[model samples]
Target chain A: MHEAITEEKWDIVIEPRSSLLSINWKEIWHYKDLLMLLVKRDFVAFYKQTILGPLWFFIQPLLTTAMYFLIFNKVANLTTDEVPPLLFYMAGVTCWNYFSETLTKTSDTFITNASIFGKVYFPRLVIPLSIVLSNLIRLAIQFSLFLLFWFYHLFVTGKISPHWELIWLFPFLIVLMAALGLGLGIIFSSLTTKYRDLRFLLTFGIQLLMFATPVVYPLSLASEKYKWLIAINPFTGIIETFRYIFLGKGDFNWIYLGYSCGTTVLILFAGIIIFNRVEKTFMDTV
Target chain B: MSGNAIEIRNLSKMYRLGEVGTGTLSHDLKRWWYKTRGKEDPFLKLGQENKRDTAGGDYVWALKDVSFDVKQGEVLGIIGKNGAGKSTLLKLLSRVTAPTTGTLKAKGRIASLLEVGTGFHPELTGRENIFLNGAILGMTKEEIKRKFDEIVDFAGVERYIDTPVKRYSSGMYVRLAFGVAAHLESEILIVDEVLAVGDAEFQDKCLGKMHDISSKEGRTVLFVSHNLAAIDRLCSKALLINRGKVVMENTPKKVIEEYSLTNYIPGEIIFEDNRFLKFLSLKQEGNNLKIVCDYDAPTPLEIPCLGFVISDSMGNKIFGTNPNYQPPKTPIKESAKGRLQIEILYPKLLNGRYNLSIWFGDGKVDYVVMENVLSIEIINMINYVRETYATASGPVSPIVEWKYDYKD
Candidate 1:
């Protein structure tokens, strides 16, 4: 066998299968154009043909916030601190929406993109990365709407003031939100490929997850005994951090925030490893 | 050696066939224990060939110990029957799926056009799809912009370039997809059965583009298709796969010859399983080759039983006859058998080895049995023939009838 191998132009050997994370990162980087196009496709095709078009981006968050205000603030007697109710809910909703949409879309990726993946080759990670990016555009539009509401409250009431010190932490909040959503999404996407039972469970699970986070009500409204519950949620830090910056209320617990940040990073790394492994062999199983 | 652009070595891909799911935790723990001890999987003993209706298995190798290198600027054709793992091999090379074992090293960017309208979005316009598909195939935005006009022009959908692709006819969609794929300037191009779409004119244009890509631009190409005629025309070299293994690799003529020989056989060739052979016809007329058949038996036989199988001197079946689709057929009666003769008229087959296998079978079960029955030699080297280009020799030349009228 050794002598025969020497005669061959390219030596051929069968090795034991290794994890797919061992794939060369340099190759994926070279395929970045495909990633960009997938992102562009998600952005354009999603809103292009609709009658409302890009306005749907703003309308979605605005309508969602209005519904929460009517249901949670007025009906359920949820506190919004001293900040205007509209401004308060819109800020929380925009950040929450980014994470929710990213997670929702990423979870469905294996099924939605199966036909393309089955036929051709591109970086499989490109699709999930595009989902995060496409959702960012929506977040930006909603963020602008939040800014408009903040200014209206500022001019009309002249009673509330946003904390300038908390503004320094905005970029960190974005990272925390994106990391948690993308990480959780990839994990769910990988699982759903095999046990399709998770697909139905995931839709119900995201709604439950919303109440666990401080999306509808501010984190300050929680009582002392249940404060531990808020700290345990990885999203607690992201939501609290956003409210602390915009509404100028909510305790800034650096220690819990650090804990949440650490969990987010760890989940992101683990998600990448699992996603890389699933991307290679998912075609066969899927 | 010869500036090889694509190099694949021992590229084996194993798949866990039948009910691929995450098993119970106990199974996982046992598998892990085996892996830790540096031993082969114990459950592997239970595995069976994918073709058989068998019980549970650890894994089955879809591709096993396959190795072949394709040179730069070479157009390599891969031909195989269904379940021969042709698509699996392409998917592995294109990185759509990973090989369970072995290594593949290829230089330069590789783009795969596995089907028509692969990256097209129905809501996006025809023009938008070209850019999207181009980008998916690895063309930069600027490159896509530069080639955009050529793609639209090639698809002949310029009038509806701005209209959403969903509105375009199926033919128009395929044309645009092929146009974008043809214009991709990657170092290697992998195309699989993409020529099966569009009208005849578009197919010709696609072939011309493929020829230009290989000959002029010198990109490596790997094409997989069942169309032997197209493979014979476009491919410089060929690989034949059977049952997930490479059987032969050589010039297109030689590979196709070996392939047709092994895989080609009449359904009725194997009779006595409640089958009786009834009819057979072989003839040559003009430059056109035609086949006609009439068969009947006591028991109802599956009509047009696996069509016709033609072989050569080496006992290799060169061709099989079957309708592309189930066209309307005249019904047959039990115990009724009739005679029908077929004539081949035309530009005679190029000089080569040839034979014929004709049978009327009930489904795969046969009535009339004939294996390597009829044979012919098309002699070449005629004196001062107007159409003579080379010495042509082969089995079966269809005789052509020509008539001329002159007035004095």
Candidate 2:
């Protein structure tokens, strides 16, 4: 029974039928321990020597939120759409953190992990997957901080209270942001393996993408003429939908949500296909 | 069926050997079109087989028409010279790269150690990398945990287990990597020249571990290396690859014997000194051939027989047989030494340069005429025979056969 199970698990002969685009997910599944190890390595090793250690997880989004509140709320006079500036930006920062972190690291996957991937045989997808997962730990910490701030504000105001709808959208929004970032990052990582110039473009591209998303200013504040542009931004709908349910500030346009989710799903599948293809023979080209 | 571990049929791998991106989009499209049409890749045909003899080629058939089977628990050594496609075969077997053509079916999990420390993250500690490398080698976390202590002990890096691999010396890092790799319980282990990096002691340790794993554990091992001694020591069966093909596959003894004989550089036939001799023919003599040049020869000289010797660029005498060993008793009127003709029959030297040392010498005296005359190129006489049968047949061969008739 044991032999049969082992045989059944890796029974398939992986003839080089096609490129990396055609991934054998079953093989990856067989080596899932490696994926888990990579995730653990990224999660623990990132802050191993730091004094603050895992505290930096909360510190990162907290600092970013404070900066956004100062710039977008204090200086730019951007409307928070009735939610407190702290709570307002926390929602945006929480979702945006997952996306940005996933994107930045995912795009650099090939370059950063080139040494390991070149010699070892593991699912290249495991790398991007681990990146997304490692960031998820940080997201959890940041989400806890956001909730703590929300309750503090609510407790102080007495009138402001948590809406149950927003609480439920939290996990959904996190997944959406992760899927979007991971999908795009995988695609970018695959492309950058050959054309490394994409890596340079991504640093600036991510900052520009921030403006495109309604993370700083609410989607409702955008002019109706340019609302389509905000809707076109995949993060805009997820972010707006997230804020609407959580802080009860931003408007949730189902049409935009549909578009964002559609784009996210499409990019996810496309990324998988492209990443799968690139992983197979990338050793040769990379 | 006696549990075949791996069955490879008509396996071939062709590599594009230049700068990868040199082929532009159109060129790529053209190449893709050519490949899609199932045409023989143009790149494979460009290079000569012997890479060391000539300047590097634009491309090579890293592996071509190589086919073999391994039985369960069989330790197969894949041995060859550099650029002989041993690594390519391992890479293909490990699925690091795909074969350009043909198909292979392997029965069990193949953990390929094409390199040690293959998946170790520099930023991660040795402890963390253990799990990482273990997983990359296809071991479960439970499996790694089960053998974690053994792995660390084998690597001998217990004190530095938590230290980042980047901080560790290359030896320590490879030790840790190989420790994890060798300890992992996999059905098949594919190791390529990774042992070449470790020191001799560590190499012996690794070879011992590999031997134990294959013999005791009954796991299949495909080991590729240029070290014939290690291969002979560890492997039950061996395959000798040459120019991307399996030239020989048999018991380790047979494969290594053929390899050594094929690669052996024939030693030289040297002369002690010159003497009063007219003719010395190495070809006329059977196996043993020796001659000396003498200076006190009271005779004239000749071109072909004039004391001439051969040496390498570094002045090592490769071959020079003179007729001076047995000097002529007749004293010449004029104090002139004569030349002697020497011919080597079936000079079994491999292709390389050699210098000839020449001089005139008598029974007890010698004088230099030409110290070194470099002129010799023994191209490999390797026939394209599928199998080179082993026989006690010496360098030169003579046909002899006998018919035996019994009462039956």
Candidate 3:
């Protein structure tokens, strides 16, 4: 009917698959406010009526660090490579908490948010990206708690020396952890949309995965027989590098860090592609 | 400028019926193989039209090759029976799901409110959710800030703005949610039955806002509602869909009329009495209301040359035929029981309820005359190009339209 004039430019064209790269950076940018609000909601909505409120963010890491310190260091005779037990365990628990939270929450993006997602159209990436970003607030809180313990170890006890020169590497390390968790999470979410068989497996898997990383005991305690499973794990390099820079006495290698970085980028890239493809039609399956 | 805000071409959506379990992996693999080989989808060929009553195969086309265009600033009402793909079409337009095939192109942004309070979290306060829902519906934070007061005032929930939405009454919640959606800054708005939510007063307010937005702001609107009166009043044009296909596209008045006629279920009206001769049944045949009667008359009677007249609601005879489209060659003799049938073929009597009067008459006397024997409704009968009823003399309300050429 509109054949008289030509050259129409439409803002949106919806079809089955919009190529392998179905992401629109501009659209995501426009929804940045939504991302910020959702992050705030996640941060604020959980602890509204609790007496301690956001203090639980700090309390949770403190309690886990205490439990791990007692079980692994005191009872099992595990060493922290000459670092303070409280500082080492707290640091491990803080960073590991952020990674696990991001991974688990992002892994179920399609299933948990099916109601809102089915009613409107927005860049679906805003969801997991916000989750990853919001958990950073918890990271900052728990990291400050670890920093207080770091100051006591450095000044009061003088028991451990730190690599202050490598302090600039800390932010990049957190970014690498986020990217790896997000990438793996979205891949699982996309695959599990039709068959949620993975949902039951994911919770137990994250618990076992923490042991694969060096969260409870330092990597030095791993025997030669079980080291490969711990070494190939990308979280090992992050934890070891984190220990090397802050506590000054654990395992850290450039090849290991570089390998982790490469794996993170590759998984994140693959995750984006799969997430983009699945988001278009996940409503039907979910 | 193509003067169209949206153009959908050959859009179709196929859904797998029943429980999808372990066997779906094979279907997915086969579909992928076909895609890699550059062949058409093998499953789309076997999909059945979406009909609720019929037993369908595994695949059903929720929407089948539906193509339509919406002009800029046009309010289009989509009316259809339940499970007739109305929701499917809106879901496609809203991008809630991708089509199995074909394309939908739209200029500017499209904000669809398939349901009110779509992303409204129960824990969030009203003010916070205003920004959240606004952003979810494609508004910028700055846009929401500028329109915040207007939204709150329009919803009339300013006093409860700081309270969590779960604490608010259901009416207040719907008002706030609809307020946020109505304030969305998009070029096209797609609303599906959301107006039926809230009180009657709030519904009128929402309708007024819709009218203002489409007319004053020159925004395109696609409305789907079972409220036919609302559709007729608001929409410039309407679409009637049945069984995954477009049945008609025309003005809202005509489409509504056609919708009634399309969904009408024919049944026998068995309420009549007679002196010695009585009636049997009356039902709708193809383009006619067929009347069948079994009579036991005291004496012989003439045939088809029976008197049949259909009167309008005003008690005036509208249209009828004496022979009722066909006459028998011979007269009826005295019989214990006899059969009589008449067809009111192509009775283009305008859409209204009417009563039928029947009587058996010859040249001199009348035999059996049953007055007001049946009442029936005629719908969508004015399909031709006739303009004779400009000034109807009888008691009637005629739909009117006027056009004029420009003058120097």
Model 3: DockQ vs. true structure: 0.61
DockQ for all candidate structures vs. native: 0.45, 0.36, 0.61
**Native contact share for candidate 2:** 0.53
lDDT of 1 by residue, B40-144 (tens): 766655444444334546577667778898998999999876677888898888778888768887777788988877878988888778878887777878898
Q: Candidate 3's C-alpha lDDT?
A: 0.83
Model 1 interface RMSD over true interface Cα atoms: 4.2
In Å, residue A209's CA in model 1 sits off its true spot by 0.8
Candidate 1 residue spans exceeding 4 A from truth: A1-29, B21-29, B43-58, B264-268, B275-408
Please identify model 3 stretches exceeding 4 Å from their true place.
A1-6, B264-408
Per-residue C-alpha lDDT of model 3 across residues A132-188, encoded as one tens digit per residue: 999998898889899899989889999988898988999999999999999999998
How does each model score on TM-score? 0.81, 0.75, 0.81
Share of real contacts kept by model 1? Answer: 0.46
Q: Best candidate, lDDT-wise?
A: 3
Clashes of each: 31, 33, 0
- In angstroms, the error of model 3 at B405 is 50
Backbone clashes in model 3, listed as residue pairs: none
Q: lDDT at B342 for candidate 1? A: 47
